[model samples]
Target chain A: MRVIQNEKLRTVLSYLIPFVLIPAVVIGGIAVFRSRGYSYLIFAVSALTILLFVCGFDRRKTGTRRLVLVAAFVALASAGRAAFSFIPGVNPVTAVTILAAVYLGGEAGFMIGAFSALVSNIFAGQGVWTPFQMFAWGMIGLFAGIFAKYFEGRKLRLCVYAFFCGIFYSLIMDVWTTLWTYDAFNLPFYLASITSAVPYTAVYAVSNAAFVWLMAKPFSEKLGRIKLKYGI
Target chain B: MTGFGSINPAAVFAYFLCVTVSGIFTLNPIISVISLAGALLLWAVLPVAKNKRTHIYPVLLTLFCAVGNPLFSHNGETVLLVINNNPITLQSTLYGLFIGIMLSAAVYWFSSFSLIVSSDKIIYTLGFISQKAALVLTMALRFVPLYIRKARQINGTQKALGLYKDETIITRFRGGVRVFSVLMTNMIEKTIITSDSMAARGYSGGKRSGYPLFKFTFKDAVFLAVTVFLTLLTAVPQAKGALDFNFYPHIDITFYGVSSVAAYTGYALLCLCPSVYEGSDRLKWHYLISRI
Candidate 1:
């Protein structure tokens, strides 16, 4: 009874910790960044916050079976990036990760998303930008997982969600780019980047939506069956 | 044996961590250019290039980074050109190029860094944190290329079987989707099968241990110290505002003294470690073989 209670407490803490920590970290980072104009410490703090969230969530919730499945999903997502290398901004990684989160578990989605970025960068080239990619994709998967039930059966809704995720991914990356390019995140530079990135963002959105639209039926059919079989 | 690849994983990680971080942090023209040159040198020395054409990605990325800044940002006093009634200033353009160089150099350095560390080393690094997660991440990264090949095979087989013979664009798209779905379903089943096998073999039996490929060496220790030292030398000048360069209102660059020059040279050496290590080793090996 004590063991079970301990486990339940850990589960609740995993969810609760991020809820409290994320806002506090964001507010603190913004405050520092605002005051300092530019600081490596600011970037480090935000990245640390995300890394903390991922590690904490993984530590409490994940098990061997789930870990293996997450690995496979991440591998599959990375392969999607490689397969679509010629097609700029179109990869099924995000869509597949979102669907996995919805069906398997949210944390699983987060794991898959975060792992996929680091893994894909092995082929795409890893850099200072890697942690940012991990954070961006990880958060996307988290949100998708959180709202998984709403997107479970609704294909169009899920496609729309994936589209937004694509734009969001690019937007976050652009913000990172600006920070890297200009030692500071100047509002004017950021705005200029966003305007220039519109076409690229659109391309990303369309490919993401297309993949989700095409992939949802067959991919989810298998996933739905697996969920039924494993009861995961 | 003293090649960059043969160095201790920890030392390689330390060196890469130092240069890449410093590269990302500093944006002075002198520093950025030194970083770019170092990066280009490393790329030239490293055997990452299979085809020369593939090198265009870095070139184009660098070019875009360097070129894109001036076009969008219309800051600075010295007007160079007026396009579409917009004034382009020399100061902002130069700043843009500086940024581009920094970005490009960072990109190149990272490319080599990935090769230097590799995935197993990454797993090893992560293993210190969580054994299970590291193993899983390693396995996933390993599976990516295999799945890519499988994807291509599935794609080719579909085409050969008259699956994607649809002439219309939409149907072709649908056909492509069908292939992806089939591919994913097949792969997922395989994943489940593998997991089932692992479970049957008692995956949760006890603690797991890897092959343990990396160990610290005396040379690596020395290299690690040098990397730390050079990185510090580079940082000191920046912290002192000696490497500061500004644009927007007008270009203002104030050089402090010999320390700034030392800082630039230090960064240059920091970036060149791998190439120097690899290059000198090759030279010595050739000389010894000739003597023999």
Candidate 2:
């Protein structure tokens, strides 16, 4: 029997699962672990497990070709970060992730984005924050993939996506920082965390926009060429 | 990857899980200090973290976490200072210090972990879970250094051919994009060829075998037991309410009973075991060399 695969279902599940599941899991863990240290670990691990399950699906496209393309993007994104190590917030992971999702598929995009964060954190330093990072980047790719048609060809649209995704990344991370700071969330503490994070979030957004504006068009052109040349 | 690195990946993973989880969950200021000290010492002694002058970032971050908490969070009883009519409470300030130490310690532990467990170990460990994932991770990890080298070589060739000028910002940008395209094309094509070659070799037909590099030994077992034992020792007191720490309303720790002291000692040993395990080997080796 053929495995159940529906594009629309995949799209809907991809978008909905992360939004619904992560918060639910965190809330669940907070009740059990009391939003303390063990709770954060449990919270992050649950998110990664759920996200990985979502990504662990068989694709009907060019098969291993998609994985290779993803590998290329992971390397490109990682090396881009390494190459541009001078600037603190400037990296092409988000743009490259979006471009990959747009060109390839959401599954590959999520895999590449999440895997890049996993592998790169080897050098960048891994922590309890790692799973949170992986989920954030993966969701960014998944979202980019779902909205690919609208943003792919347009430079302005791509830049806007990158900037917002960048802010979104920081915002997700800020939630983790908040949980870590107080062990659980209260309205005032979380708001304080968000406000404190505003400066860094702005930096992240601007850097993302600057990189996407410079790189997305040319990178997409190259991605298209490879896709055509190899029937990928 | 020897000495402390020789420990089995599973054991290392367990050690980190216990220490990091316990460390984060309990904000006992004493435990935080010990974790910070142990982590910093391990980082300094780690073979791979030699060029870590970038440690200034974590130091600054630690300071920021320590100082910044009081400004935004003023939910404590004891007023430490009043800056701009905002009462900076003692609880928040101390809490901030605890967080700063936790973050800094976590950073050091992470650096040391990265150094000890290279990608091959990750691949080897992951092989047991899912072969397909392990293979992909291996390929991606291998591709990174390879692609970086090729990109550098291409950049050199482009420079030599005078195809791209490095003088102006726009020229450099144009040149970088062209180089990036070429690199992507080469890497992706190479990946396809490699996959094809694997297909020809009947890669999917047979179960792939990992190298017998890492084997869990009795020593690993003992080390693992010690870490778990320490964690269990700490857990007993944590259950007994001796390890409780409150930060928001007021900075308070439970009474330092015999159990608390035992827990602190156990936690310290747990954190420092890696450094001692690695350092002791060096000490013996150096003593022999000096004798010779």
Candidate 3:
């Protein structure tokens, strides 16, 4: 018997099922456990597994060379944040996330940004804010992906783009953090936002400039060669 | 991959069912502790590879959440420290810690469940969902990195052509936007092409048969039975109105009696036993494989 199978049909189903089932299963498990603590852990683990599995499939596409590249990218993207945290006024996360978006597109940018945040948080610790952080960083990557389309690959342009991306990233994340923890339309919100804006914004600008200046040209050129070679 | 301890998807489904039913009505500390211990024991006993450092993140998060709670809200009795002329009550902090711990435990257990249960099993259990929908969900999950790789490749190409310039803030912003638009356009085009391919294959015509590699065995029945029993036991505290939740005045537990705590503990232990059995069997498989 012939089974009717469509690539698109399968693709659609694949995406939808995990998105719905992941949250559903997690929420359901939380209810049974009656502990929000356990539920959040499960959510993080599940998301991580799903992302890793997806990356594994991607590995099959181009063999070990590409797999290594992807892994390196993820590792750098993840470690970059921690390193940035140490810098006097640098926020590597915003810079890297923005760079991922500009180069990778929305889905990949979102995944890398979110996954990097999630993975990094293992050191930072997991909490209710884990998801929020993931969403925030993920948005940065997504916007970058959307934004990357307009820019031409030039050193001067990249530096400027990275700077603004940094600023946007800090502003958006600070707003989200404020909303999540604090009440709306209040003094707390105003104080939290402004206070966070200074350090975060300054760090973001410096980091963006540093990353764009250092990596933009060679990285872009290498990526271009790979595309031509693969004809993808 | 064969001979690894098998997990019954049905049992897992039932376990989740039980958790959902019980968790909504009460946040039972005893149950939470029991579940936490059971999960930890299973993790310890399981044949799966261990990464102890990975545990740090969850722990840190719990502490952060617990400590941060007081900074936001100030309520409850039993004052402890007076911070900046504000009463930092012992009750509130303790309560916060308890909630944080419970939340962390729950998250850990869920993550454990994900590790135990494979996605294939998830698909099998959720077979009732339309094939089209299922396919889409899996594809999206699968596509995250693929899209990233493609976007990066495109960006690299643009840079090589000297089309990209990093100068003024506005110019860079403009360049970034241009890259994104191109990527999005490509994605849309690819999506349409994929959709067309699906349409041609009669994807939406009617019902589709599912092909599961494994069949239900007697072990599955036994597993389901055990999980169902444990699920019921976990739910008893909620059903009997014995489960207590105190957000203030120091986190305290007054179980119906000693019997309830014992029963909960026993049930939790029973829930954890199977992982041991399965894990051992998996170890044997690995041993044989290595020898071969």
For candidate 1, what is the TM-score?
0.84
Runs in model 3 deviating more than 4 A are A1-232, B1-5, B16-26, B70-77, B165-179, B250-252, B270-274, B279-292
Docking class of predicted structure 1: acceptable
Point out the higher-scoring one by TM-score: 2 or 3.
Answer: 2
What tens digits encode model 1's per-residue C-alpha lDDT throughout B42-62?
Answer: 877875443465467667876
Error of 2 at A69 (Å): 2.7
Query: In model 2, which regions exceed 4 Å deviation?
Result: A1-47, A54-62, A86-88, A147-157, A184-232, B44-49, B52-55, B160-163, B167-171, B236-241, B256-262, B283-292
Model 1 chain B worst lDDT run, 10 consecutive residues: B46-55
In order of TM-score, best first, we have 1, 2, 3
In the range B1-292, model 2's lDDT, one tens digit per residue, is 7678889887898888778766776667888888889888888877674665658867897788778888878889999779899999988888887788887787778777777878777767654434455566777778788878988999999999989797875576557667776787687678778877777876655534345457778999999999889987876676566667777686666776798888888888998899998899889889999999
| Chain B TM-score of every predicted model | 0.85, 0.86, 0.77
Which candidate's lDDT is highest? 1
Assign candidate 2 its CAPRI class: acceptable
10 residues in a row with least lDDT, candidate 1 chain A: A1-10
Leading candidate by DockQ = 1
lDDT tens per residue, model 1, A107-197: 7777788889888888877777777788788888888889988998889999999999998888888877777667667777788888888
Query: Which numbered prediction scores highest in TM-score against the true structure?
Result: 1
